[model samples]
Target: MNPARALIVDLPGPDLTLEEGRFLARHSFGGVCLFARNITTPERTARLVRDLRDALGHDALVATDQEGGAVLRRLDVPHPPTPMGLGALRDPEAAREAGAVAARGLLDLGINWNFAPSLDVNVNPGNPVIGERSFGSDPALVAELGVAWALGSEAAGVMSAVKHFPGHGDTQVDSHLDLPTVNKSREALEACEWLPFRAAVRAGVGSVMTAHILYPALDGERPATLSPAVLTGLLRGEWGYDGVVVTDAMDMRAIADRYPGGVGAPLTLTAGADAVLVCGHGELTPHAEHLNAVERALRDGTLAEDRLQEALTRLASAARRFPGTPRPYTAAERERDGAQVRAWARASVTRVGQVPRLSPDAEVLLLTPDQPGVGGPYGDSLGGDELAATLRAYFPRLRHANYSPTDARAARALLDEFPGAPALLATPTRWNLTPVQKELAGLLPARGGIHLALWNPEHARALPLPALVSYGFRPAHLAAVAQALITGEAPGVLPLAAPEVV
Candidate 1:
């Protein structure tokens, strides 16, 4: 097989430039993955995909990480709640609806493949990366919901890849910055990490994306992305998964920082990954180096020609399944698609502790931490102004304040000024808050108000009070929190036990 068919590259911008076009035309890249940077508008996104295909001379698979919630790349659209939120509803149908909505939106943007339905069982609450992104901590629940998502996307004619294979949910380190190790023995992995993957494979998932993590008990030296023991011996030989094996973004620090240019890409492919995904905001020249390395490996007999051919075959099969013509939708159809997302949001609210009864005439103080952006981790940061505006819809007599925990004066003033009024504090889940932020979050419980965690189910445990967790902080998540606050009702249950409960 041509080694070029084993690589997937990314564009530098929303529009295809001359250099990018030339590079794309010269290489038989198996796919091209899009990001938020490549999407200026729906029209521009569709145009870019078409342009990439035109340059490549064939319909290459176009993929995106439109997993909804915090990982949503498409902006200005209604996104379903995070997978953890869906798991909280204890309804696989909600998971399917979320997947279908994501598929419809991705298809509208000319994307054929979705890197979604993360099969990782979020067994560790401290995992910074996979927090609310996972379906839930229970392997059975994750498997059930993950399969529903994969089938839902497939129903929309979009190829689905259950990701971060072998589980990325037990480590605290983010693979984007560095490699994380899962020390579980083979038996432990089979019992926990491998459960969802097995179910996904049984459900006929089209692709499996290898995690950029090390399992010391499996292959002590190499990460799963480059370990033949993990990829070939276990995933293929033991599990009998004949579907495509795609590596996580080779540009990520776990690979790029560990192995020099062109090293990780070829190593991953040689390790049994059918496709090496190189996605980032850097130069495209590295992609050429990766392709060249694959070519050299094939010629030198370092990488078997048959293995390369097998990958090409898988890519061809995936392309055949998604012919790359995204069916257009009417405004009404788009609205209907968005309505499902909204419905999931409504049923995905989880409340902890006792629901406080507030007097209609009493003033409610909304406390949000001072952050740099408009929202916090996983999405646009909710600036002090926007946070207040969003909460005002639910609490009409609301007064907003932003405090930096580091400033003693600000903390003292914030604590003193809001004594009489009931306060609701917005906290981040994945954020390991500073001492000051922790102090502020801890102080909120004593002040007699609800602790609203905006990121994951575990954030409230950091507080000294009972908290309401939203699994996400997107518009839908925030809206759900607001609705629950206004109506004093929470329909969803916590997917994972809160830190206090444990």
Candidate 2:
């Protein structure tokens, strides 16, 4: 009854196989979310969506976590820089333009719902998960840019979901690892954490995803996912958010570890969420079992029918708002959006430190970490090979080394051999440094040496060095950083939270 509540499934990419589409149709799931693994090209992605819709005979909610920058999920298609990179421009108009470009790209690939424009106010620079993904450290800046991005997405006819509601910015631990707890008082949350979510609600964001975080001050024993104080009391009652409230992936360690009895989906739904996400099979089986239990509870009159009806209504309203249609991007539009994203990326790059020029015969080593999971292949130069090529065009004698964690010692030995030369360390923000790399960083001359932390700025903060440079590490950002480094010009302002000197 009522479509058995809505569920969003994650696909490898835009291109779905016949078997995958059938599996989706058979399950009668409400929607699907795309990642880079499923996308190889725009045309192929659009075709896959079309095929799925035809097979399903119902408008499936096709969505993507296309937040741009380092969080970009679809590499086969072009999209703009991440929200933080756009925020770096410090221009609302630029942020809007980048948002429009991303919206256009998603729409072209037949993605209607964009789980993006993260409204999380990243006040904590050491936040591993949300560093470059967040708009900025300041709540006001995040609200302004987030609103612009939301409006842009709506304008392009793509439904936008501002997330992780309540807020996930200030926590030190990643929800992927364990449940993060926010001990800040209610007043503090309203002033600092809730600012951007409130702004998004005012701007008419279509959906808000709940975090797996626990706010002890809000509700003592339960995480936000299972806390009525958070979802019903704060979001729906106080803020009066009428949009769909979807829970973050239940498969994440935060919820899984706590809810060992597999009560997440039911608890989340009962707690006021419109939909609960069962991200992977490990969580899906339990979620399905929970749904059956919920049905049983309804039969026994333990779960109120009205509560289920309310959730159904929200899901139906959201689905009705998004009329599924194929929105293809022309070549000219693709180029235009690509250019806009690159311009924003260029503006977002920031140089945190400077290094003295090395001798003409010295080598400038570039080390990149390996890509995890089943997504795109890790680039030879930390996804900045093109930028490196551009650098070499001008400085042909510049030597570079690209190494994974396994070769950390070799990479460090190479750097040691060239001690007379100025060293440059380039690695993805996602890459965790090996012990050898850490030791090498200690050995390098602090003043004239440069450590360029590409990708996540949070990673840079962890390094035990005094002078560290952070480039948000998108393709355009890489180009911007390379140019800035060569020209001795800083790209943007230092992060609000700078690394402390040891």
Candidate 3:
């Protein structure tokens, strides 16, 4: 019963440290998960992954969150638009191509497991975390796009993990911060949240990531991550998901705040999760302490040995599916992927109301905020820089005012200064915005000539203003929104129900 071989751990830096290598060898850990801190260049990342595998003395599942939207790991890669952006394009095939591109990038970095294709049906409009990261509000669209991605990634020789199941899309709380509870009945879940997972399983997804949310209808006490009813009974027995079940990061507050040290590891595995993801941001506890807990559980007959073997078998089987060597990519392939991504961006930017055509001499007031540098549904590196530059290109007399969303005084002063001047207000709706930013969004249109540019379209219903929902914060998306605003031509049809305000 090698519990270490069933655990997936994270590195603290770009290079494979001797300590990490010794830990991997000592415990026979299943894999190493990478982050931005561990990825500097493709060449370096490939070497680091190879080094880690060498230390394990066996092929391990090298994984990373290569989900292209805001949850990007490799900074140099051409980050594709978000899942919602692809949904807006109404082309699942484009999603497949995007998945292939994302897979190729991962494979090039010697990463095998692509923890992506989030199958969560974003049913709740106010969901803080899984809003725009979801494909759309519709379950059918989410399933179609998710299955396409899984198949496409498989084709690229990279394993795909359709994530956060039973579903994390309905809750207002981020499981990273706290454990959220879902009150939906089994029938409700089947019609909405369960649809995508069922579809992905049928499509032969290599893995399913467990959510940290609790559902009283399923397991009243345990979260899905540690619930046999959800993990074994429902996912395996009912849905027949024979693939690997991964925990959403063990270090997250949802799991950590409740279960200390390695307590959650054996519990989740016993609950039917095949692999536990103990990915610390930088600092990781000693693997011996965690491995000892697992060893103790098996020794005391608390965790079944057969269950541990089953997990190891599944992990090894998934690792074997990936190519032994990372395939090389050419300039042509990169260019082709970039072109497809740009085309998708152009098709996905949804516009609402008439964007007043600004003359070169028109005084344009640009109200932009600082970029949300964090990852997830809310923020990415790609922010107002491209939009500001693009807007300035069109409007020669553009004036810039950068303020925090919470700055009411600044917002009032700016509104007073540029009253009725055609203003381009770029605001992020979902997270990190202050009360002033949210308030300013509602207050801007009444001041006139305010064309609201939503960074996150989920907030569209909340803000009753004529707006342009760009779907994402990429530079390509900025260009697409600019085109829609200038030409009044957007091919995107809302994949979900259009907001009544729009």
Best of the candidates, lDDT? 1
Q: Please give the range of 10 consecutive residues that has the lowest summed lDDT in model 3.
A: 374-383
CA shift of 272, model 3, Å: 1.2
* TM-score sort, best first: 1, 3, 2
lDDT of 1 by residue, 39-109 (tens): 77889888898888888755588988888777888866667568998888889987887788888788887
Native RMSD of candidate 2 (Å):
3.6
| Candidate 3: C-alpha lDDT | 0.79
State the C-alpha lDDT per candidate.
0.80, 0.68, 0.79
Off by over 4 Å in 3: 373-387, 411-415, 418-420, 446-448, 451-454, 498-502
Q: What is the TM-score of each predicted model, taking all chains together?
A: 0.95, 0.87, 0.94
Q: Give lDDT: candidate 3, residue 360.
A: 61
Q: Kindly provide the TM-score of model 1 when superposed on the true structure, using C-alpha atoms.
A: 0.95
Q: Give the TM-score of candidate 3.
A: 0.94
* Candidate 3 clash figure, as a count: 1
Q: lDDT tens digits, residues 369-471, model 2?
A: 4442212212223443554565565456665655555556655666666765566665564544566556656756552556666666655555554333444
RMSD of each: 2.1, 3.6, 2.4
Which order, best to worst by lDDT? Answer: 1, 3, 2
lDDT of 3 at 482: 67
